[model samples]
Target: MIEEPGRVVAIEREAVWIEALDEAACPGCTASVGCGRWSFDWLETPRRRRRIRALSVMPLRVGDAVVVGIREDFLLRSTLAIYLLPLLGLFVCTIAIQQLGFGESLMIPAGFLGFVSVWAMVRRISRRQMNDPTLQPVVLRALPGASEGQVRQAAF
Candidate 1:
């Protein structure tokens, strides 16, 4: 499981909305002198606060600090779906258009149509996945210092 610490911001029935407590840090690299990211610090924008609605495994209060987790395979699959699927759709469409003896001028438009279609398909797949508990982030544990009553509630 990939875990991050978050503070519960709201409790809605079985779901808890968590605000991430950690900011992503740049990786220290020896090649920073040649990296554009190093020179773009002045232009960098602050990251927006990320709030995730995660499945609550135990009773929680709005102020509780807890650990949230997702499966590593789920992360990888989501990455591939988001980045690679559309590109594949574009290529496949372009090739199909060419093979069907369409004019070269039509290939670009066909590819665009295909990309949009696949993107919409991906969106639908994700919407359906929203109900799949295995794909959603889960509250793994409350951080130490939680009230004893909450722990006792979880134990049963």
Candidate 2:
């Protein structure tokens, strides 16, 4: 299970809202800042809060810790809906436009533009969905020893 520590920002009867602690240092880095890439460290600074929603598995209070991520099936379904639906719409629209007896000059450009528009819309929707923290699933809960300060401490 891919798990990350987060603090409970809100607690409801059926759901819990947790905010993931941002890492101060780039977790992707392997170096000790000996390289010339220290200039990029500014980009690695953590944000203040990232709210996530989860089904309440345990009685959690405000300021508790939790982890969030989608199940594999849910992730797959989300990807297909976000990606394949637009492509299918593009394909169907193109075919319908071609069969409508419009001239190639008009039909081709319209079809191409339709496909592009669908692709652009998919991208926009995907970005918007990614911005919604509630879409993500809560997969695990952190132990009582987990410290938000430790998670936010910069390694560089």
Candidate 3:
């Protein structure tokens, strides 16, 4: 499971919108203690906000902070469904068409068609799985404090 803390932006019944910052996983290589990397990283990188809705186990309000989690397999499965099938479709269709002595013109169109067809098929299969429990992220618990004193007390 992968989890992150986010601030809840809105609530609608069981669903809450959470906005999480997408931080760069690495800031520097081994060489730099005080180098140009900090300024380079700053200008090249933009503020990234990733927002998603999660089913909450507890009642939530706007401005509340919470922990959200999703299974690792969800990421793997989604990537394969979106990318791998289309690439395989192009190879299979193009090769099969060429084996029949079709010209490049026919093979190219056929491969493009194969890519679109496979992409559509993957979309349909994934849509049918929209209600699958493993794919849905959920809010695990609320954060303890939103203000200064409560946060300081909890830190001790």
TM-score, per-candidate, Cα-based: 0.78, 0.59, 0.76
Candidate 2: where is the Cα deviation over 4 Å?
A: 22-26, 29-48, 104-136, 149-156
Worst 10 residues of 1 by lDDT: 147-156
lDDT of 3 at 80: 88
So what's the TM-score on candidate 1?
Answer: 0.78
Deviating ranges (above 4 Å) for candidate 3: 25-45, 146-156
The backbone clash count of each candidate, in order, is: 0, 1, 0
The full ranking of all candidates by lDDT, starting with the best, is 1, 3, 2
Q: Against the true structure, candidate 3 has what lDDT?
A: 0.76
Q: Candidate 2's residue-wise lDDT over 1-156, tens digit each?
A: 345667788876667887875543356677737645555545666455667777666777887655655666657767787778767767777777778877767766676777778778878877887646456566365545457665333212
How accurate locally, in lDDT, is each candidate?
0.79, 0.65, 0.76
Model 1 residue 44 CA deviation (Å) reads 5.3
lDDT leader: 1
lDDT of 3 at 26: 38
**Order of candidate numbers by TM-score, starting with the best:** 1, 3, 2
